[model samples]
Target: MNSLPPLRQPCPPGTCTCRRDELLEEPGADLRILRLTRHEEQRLLERLENIRSLADLERLQQRMYEQLGIRLSVSPSHNEVRSMRGIVIDFVEQPGLCRKTRQAIPAAIRRGLERQPEIAYRLLDAHDLLRDA
Candidate 1:
């Protein structure tokens, strides 16, 4: 069983802020705080539409690194990382790949690759390159 102390919020003159932690602790609380503004949301949606495959993923990663300097990569699962890297390398060696073949890459990574193209791509590429022989 998980137990945490009740949260206490800073009090203003005759006013109290809700304890965010306590609220989050409640079962089935669906509270979400939006971190991005409207423009950011629109940009993210647009970027997501452009990602297609491993090359696109790479490009997106590079774009992110240049723009925001955040690095994204695959988890440290040996087999999955190796497989993804192979796909990326294959795409690199051969350009003008068919859309059907490109579709084989995972959609989640594709979307991520789109959102912050540069950084995510570099991190993923580096991870793929360094994890194995």
Candidate 2:
């Protein structure tokens, strides 16, 4: 068995489920939070309404970085350093996604995020902080 702890979903506190999504709008203690500008929100929502495949999700992810300047490198639980791809994968899998796309988003996101880098959670340990102590 792998000695590493299981990866926690990168959902922000209280916003993991669709039931509490309003809290996401208000913001909370997510490590790498993506704060959206009004125009970006509008554009993202419009794009989400039409997402049907992995490509669509990838395109939106790129658009957020390129156009809106929104990118989050989240440390989900102080162990996992999730890149933008991982963050976007988590975001795209939210319940807000259309029902037609919901079931497949997780798998798609997994494939995409895995392609980004190794599954190793790059975290800072006490040793690194105080070397030779």
Global lDDT scores for all candidate models = 0.42, 0.39
Per-candidate RMSD, Å? 16.2, 15.9
Tell me, by lDDT, which candidate is best: 1
Residue 69, candidate 1: Cα error in Å is: 1.5
Candidate 2 deviant stretches above 4 angstroms: 1-40, 72-133
Over 1-133, each residue of candidate 2 has an lDDT whose tens digit, in order, gives 8673222233455533432244335555331223443344445555554555444554666765564343423223333334533332334333222232233434444444355333213212311423446
Which digits, one per residue and each the tens of the lDDT, describe model 1 over residues 1-133? 9974332222343332334345456776423321223354346446645656556655765764354332344433444544333223222311122233234333545455545556454655666745556
> Candidate 2: global Cα-lDDT?
0.39
Clashing pairs in 2: none
